[model samples]
Target: MTKTSAVFPQPAPGSKPTPRVYTDEQKSMIEELRQYALSLLLPETDSYHPNERRWIEEPECPARYMRAAKWKLDDGKRRIKGTIEWRREYKPDLISAEHVKIENDSGKILLNGFDYDGRPIITMRVGRQNTQPSERQILHLIFCLERAIDYMPEGQDSMLILVDYKSATLKSNPSISTALKVLHILQDHYVERLGRAIVTNLPMLLNFFFKGIGPFLDPVTREKMKFNPNLHELIPDEHLEVDFGGKFDYEFDPDSYWEQICRHAGVNADGSRFEPEWKRTQMPQQEQEESPKPVDSETSSTAPDLVADDDDVESSRAPSVQLPRASKPVSVKGGSSGKEGVEVIGEEEPNVLVASA
Candidate 1:
């Protein structure tokens, strides 16, 4: 198997690098688990996602599963078996771009850039979440995960997560059940796939949301989470966005980004799925309107309770993390380029999702 540069956060200058070493017994366990995985007769399906198949057969996969299962042979086998079953039932590979355009267009989650370690980065703008929590929302996240894996360089089995809480209010957070489902998918199905997680600009009240999901977080995954990390240390300045204190100047262009991601996923801007020779078509349009006025980040205060009980939903609806809107107007790049150009409003700005869901 191919190998990348020394594991990231390269050893401190003048310090000895402690490369990972597996004991002979651990190696044997991994070998046994690998054989067990290969011995399974998977149910015949129309097709499998390349990554899913890769996760089963790759040389590094067994070790990853064993690591996730804490080097227990039987537990590793069970984890692998469970993930295979989940993938078969979920068919995450079949999720179409048109089906998730609303969530994608919201720019709530994006797969972009790479960390210093070459792991693809997934940036989740919690503040931009506009839809109610639902299965589709989970699918959008899974879709992004599949795409992030696609971007992973060979020999690299993990990806980085950046949760941007800028302008996230208690109302913007997903329901607890939805968050738990997301955690279940990530921890149980996507074993050993998180390199690190950096949650930035989180508001004080959002702490409630984190606390709700805390118990369910895998120990390894929880340890990977870093609150308010210095972005420059993990991501190169060129790839890091200005919003996150890097030299890279990026404004989220919803239409262009959506179409680009759709095409990459073998689908058109419309709901049509196509193969190699598919032609690009014009995206549909609807009435467009400006979003609500921006809230001043420095002055706006966080809400009281982020994870309110169902009966206290009204109080939980208050906004939390507020970010100052961009001062200058930026041009919209895709279908609605005809507009005089909307001011870069708050996270609530509507860059319309044109596909019929």
Candidate 2:
């Protein structure tokens, strides 16, 4: 099937980026939220809730909450207070690699790459999921979400989510309950943090999956969802994965990638936090020339017979679904040191294959 391109007007080259100008009323609401946050008495111990106070007092965080509450001071205060209490229970910041290592075994969720707007990208490959539906899976997701939020640089408040359903069938889709839980967490605590969500290679059968979670999604979150758009326009070729028709050919290595994530989080094997070297280490580097030519959106084409087979021994038993045929064939490569490779088969189906490094 031909992929349709979604055109977002790109800012003119070298144009001065617009700055956020808030009105006086909004400013007052933000200040009120900040004051409310400051008045709370959190535990002095940082281990259980590291950076708790600082996060509440973060200059941009209160504004984000206020905007999420539609600038209503009371509503925003309730949201802020609720989130503070929820963090104490959820401990998203304290979720460690050891706590969710098993969930990472299949490399299902990854925090890598950036979008054209420089928002950090979190790619979730549902077909690669190895575990049954459980609360641990949610913890794993919260861990990755925290890491993504921490990776955000100044001036960037949102993240880009790429949910790839390449080898996914109806059986592999997340349960409605789990989906609703995810929706609640994202829409509530992580308010206004989704820059955009691009759901690619989605199977028709999985349309019901979205329909199941549709009602719980905030209208704004629903609007951020994009389906099978030309990803090249949204992500730079260097950062885009080859699995999604870009130059970055990243294979998933569960072991090494997990270590990379742990090191970034500065957590010990037992789930305790430690001071990392703070070196310039990053997610697996993209191995390409200093500057690679970007793919021309107008001239780009995909393999007509390109297909991803559910070759995972664990997920092989789950039946696959027939997928729309593409225009060009993509060569799949396996990774070294526990990196799982993608095996492209005939034009049978496109399942959940995450294109992340």
Candidate 3:
């Protein structure tokens, strides 16, 4: 009896699954949602609470806010026009001992109160703190507050003048030296575009005061206020002189300058400069004379013959070969002569050979 052996099938090894691909419509929808989410939920803005006094994050936040605010303001109107009003209020002194308040059974009173009332009175004090407004926040607050006041008509002229004066003072003040240094640091360390935008927009903030809000100021006061001449220009011309040492003087022929710089650095601007002049240094006089000739097949074939003729002439002039003696006897009848001799033989007709020998 013959028995068949059992056969087993092997399982296939697992392969990696392919990533799912989204359709164009799905991708477009996803991008749209991402943009909307980014606009609405800016992480930088979300980090700061509304009540916080710091405005350093305003550079990213105010732009988004202004866009929305402006859209809302101009939705129904053809040209929305308005004016802004600003004013400076003296902060209450908080550092003096007299500024401190004590609460009594009848009322709250300053320690140095001239007259004390029996009614409840709250004391409010203000003073300079270690923390100051960020430059970005200061500009944002100025812009937003100006916009807010512009939307409203009350005290428009007065506020415009005040904002301009305040901005000018800030621009000229030495107190913000640290902030300016920080701005420079930011420019160096952060994305260059962002730093440049921030620096550039600082002037725009001033321009906004002078141009956008300046019109509302009283004619006499407007004449008194002067802006830095450079403030209005976005990018200065090459010939223009900026108050700072920085100037724009770009080379018209940068390639020429590059060549000169490379030369000064002890580097060849082009490879040909370092290459030996073969015509002047390495080439023989004969080679230089013959270098320009074109070598076709006829010329190339004749070149070997010319070289061989030169070699033959040189060999003939050499003292190595012994010449045959002219006085030697000659034999012409197919007979040998018993002396050193030369012989000549006549040609004969050719004979055919048989295949079988």
Candidate 4:
């Protein structure tokens, strides 16, 4: 038997086996499962119409399915296996979930909380639930006015509409003052644009300027005046009969309306009386002498007497001290004449030693 090289061809070293391809039926099943998982995560909104439903529902369907479905192939085998391990690892952090829950709760509480005085903190509540505006709301309005005035079109006047249905309800609220201050600031800051305008339906404006008599029929005067109603009742076709187009509506007098408002409100139009200028009164000669004189530059230049008086007071207040005199040296009897010579004296008797020159 001729020993022909009967060598079985060894598989190529380090070569990866071909991956197994999923059958169409298996692939379809896996896709359906993935879609089911996605549906569980995101619920469909009921806002869509029948025709629009398909587009809205399937908008993120592909991405959702792709994220949800995960599979792995066994080493060089065509068998496809679904992974539940990844799903177990995909749990959302408990802390994150808790944080979201807490945030939502706190937001709800803040929106609905009341002060010690039983007043709502936030002003922008639905409907007439909270008619009175809070300090925050007033501040918000001020900021809005500033932005509006900055960007308003030229010649087209800007108007701020403050709609308050319940004037009587907010009568006792302290926030009313804050609201008024905001209005005053807006009016004063935009004085150049004063004619530009502020259109408000709040009965408080009429109450404030018209002496609180126009909105309701005056029981004492028996005068009936129209007032603001609900928004739904306001007809778009309706127009205010007053000729607001006129430059001066009442009597063609400049500042007529403002003057009238001030009059009705019992306020001085000139504001001089409200903030009067202080006047100086002439003092008696004796009183003037008694009062301390202010040291001006003229008085300071000729105050030599004052300077001499200060110097005398300083010298008198100083402690007394005796300084050694440098005028003369004491002469010692029979003292040494040479510079290097030394002399000794007894304690009891005066004795002197002299060096020969």
Candidate 5:
């Protein structure tokens, strides 16, 4: 197994440095989970190729699953299993930014420059944008996470996410279930990926979502979370988006980003609209990024399409989280399968899954 520094210097100059590397026992568990997860995620279809099989073995990939599992084989196994199920259902790698692109959502969730640690700066305008349905929004977020992960080099395996809260309201706040799931995925699946989560211009109504979210955060991530009333403190000017008090005028361009993602995912855009090309690298390609195009009037994914009734859904057998749209006290709906009722549990924290249905 390889090692990289995933922790950052604390805001307190005298604070002790934290542990970021996986221990030997954890490493062993990671290897085990990797072997098992590979079996689950890799389909014996015609699409399977020798080089394609190498993705799960990428240096940091397995280790991430272990850390999310907190070094427990059982936990790691479940995380991998659940991820495999989600992957099949959402088919994330096949999902191109072009296919889910919202012209207006470009700024709502834009990646501008690199941070001091050299991680990409991803600033999301939660107050202004609603790009996709809760589930698709989560999927798009996963896509962004994929891009962020692909581009990061070994030592700098993270990104700085600034959730802009300028004009936030209760209605605008994403459903608690989706927010929890997204945060859970980030902490668990990505491992040491959030360098800083600067939440600027917070609204009072947004407090409930944050409160429910408090229990799920990783210690390191929780420590890194800050309410930056002013973005100038944590985010550098070059990496900061103009709307969020930074110099850069960043916008999300599906075409450009999709091209980059295609190359990263080893795919291409041909006569088929989106073609899977084997030439893409699993990691970030060292290329110059051009300025993204301007955003438009497109609407984001609505809650009805993705936000699920999480209250009735237990957190134990959560093979797949039902992402129904945002509403108060969700109505009774069919279980995950709609026929055979599967007991679902959301043991999502620091990104670990306890079991699968």
Candidate 6:
């Protein structure tokens, strides 16, 4: 199979870059929907919701909510409301950039380049992530997800999570209960924001872990989960890091991003309020657009040939914040942490994995 490049336009040497231009009609539609969503999120007559209050009011924020709703007025309004409610319950703002000290956890989480669809690619090395406290890690993950909101390309409301299972041992795999909880928060609270996922370097033992949770997922969400050793199946070479056979190497200094957050919020390490940098000029919401490279296409190449069968294990899914559903049950055994690295589900162990009641 051949590869197709993304449509991100490149600037030729000595040529000035082209500025992105939105038509007047396009701008009006975006602004109008954003304002409508705001009405639902924050009404004049009612007291303020915490989520509404804590939310960064960047202009693009509304555009993202609208895109998540596919631009349907009613649906968009409902989506925004749900997110606000979820934020209040989850209290993501409290996690802030400082709480997640990432000096040792870089292997656990990272935001990489964009995929073919222009969605930011976030890779999770599960083996690497398992070292941290589950709840802390989950909180940081949510915080990063929110942080990505500021950097997403236009028209993309979601991003991709690449769960890299390389070097995964029984001790390093995330506990079933903990993994389920993380998934629930993402699906139930975040909702409709996940674009897709690539579960790379899967070991056979954990196949049962994925299989056990498969029953809860709808076919559409499940279908989005692609199991492949090769990253090229979902993204182009230029967008990938050398670890996955791409041009660039994945290098993220967690503190650098955290400091960015600190600067944006205008707070010191102690978390007291101070004047922010962008505040001197325009608030972040009205500032210049992000300068991420475009996702160009290589249409002439053949499609990538996947080594693994898509049906062998359960697939990944996108965000779907807190939708109502009846209880569904399923079970699969996990590897033990002992010498053999196999975990047998004992009587004391959990037998059912049901995300919703």
lDDT of model 3 at residue 165? 18
Q: Over the stretch 1-357, how does candidate 4's per-residue lDDT look in tens digits?
A: 121111111111221122224567646554554444434342333221221223214332222223223322121011111112111121110011111211111111111111111111121211122223322233223322332332222222222122223332333222333433433343223222221111223344334433332223112111111222221111111111012211111122213222322222122321111111111122233211111121221223321111100001222122211221222222211101000111111121111110000
Model 2, 110-151: lDDT tens per residue? 776666565777888878767665555666677778777765
Score each candidate by Cα lDDT. 0.56, 0.58, 0.20, 0.22, 0.47, 0.47
Say which candidate scores most in TM-score: 2
Between 3 and 5, whose TM-score is larger? 5
Candidate that scores best on lDDT: 2
Please give, for residues 1-357, the per-residue lDDT of candidate 6 as tens digits. Answer: 223222122111121212334567656766776666556564543333433544626545555555445556566566667766665444554343444444224446665456555566767776664333434455556656765554455455566677777876666665566556656666555554566656766788777887677666644345456665346544555556667776544354555444444444343442233444434444444443222111111221221211111010113211111211212211111111000111121122212222110
TM-score of 5: 0.60
Residue 139, model 3: Cα distance from true site in angstroms: 10
Candidate 5 per-residue lDDT, tens place, 1-97, comes to 1221121111111111233565687677778877886676555553422222545667766666665566677877877676555544444444444
Candidates arranged by TM-score, highest first: 2, 1, 5, 6, 4, 3
Worst 10 residues of 4 by lDDT: 334-343
Tell me the spans in candidate 4 whose CA falls farther than 4 Å from its real position.
Answer: 1-135, 160-162, 166-168, 171-176, 192-357
Worst 10 residues of 2 by lDDT: 336-345
TM-score of 1: 0.67
Tens-place lDDT per residue, model 1, 164-191, is 8788776676657656666677778878
Superior candidate under TM-score, 1 versus 2? 2
Give the higher-TM-score candidate: 1 or 6: 1
lDDT of 6 at 198: 66
Cα-lDDT of candidate 1:
0.56
Instruction: State how far residue 285 of model 3 sits from its true place (Å).
Output: 99
Name the runs in model 1 displaced over 4 angstroms. 1-25, 43-54, 262-357
Off by over 4 Å in 5: 1-29, 39-43, 46-52, 103-106, 130-135, 216-221, 229-234, 242-246, 249-305, 308-357
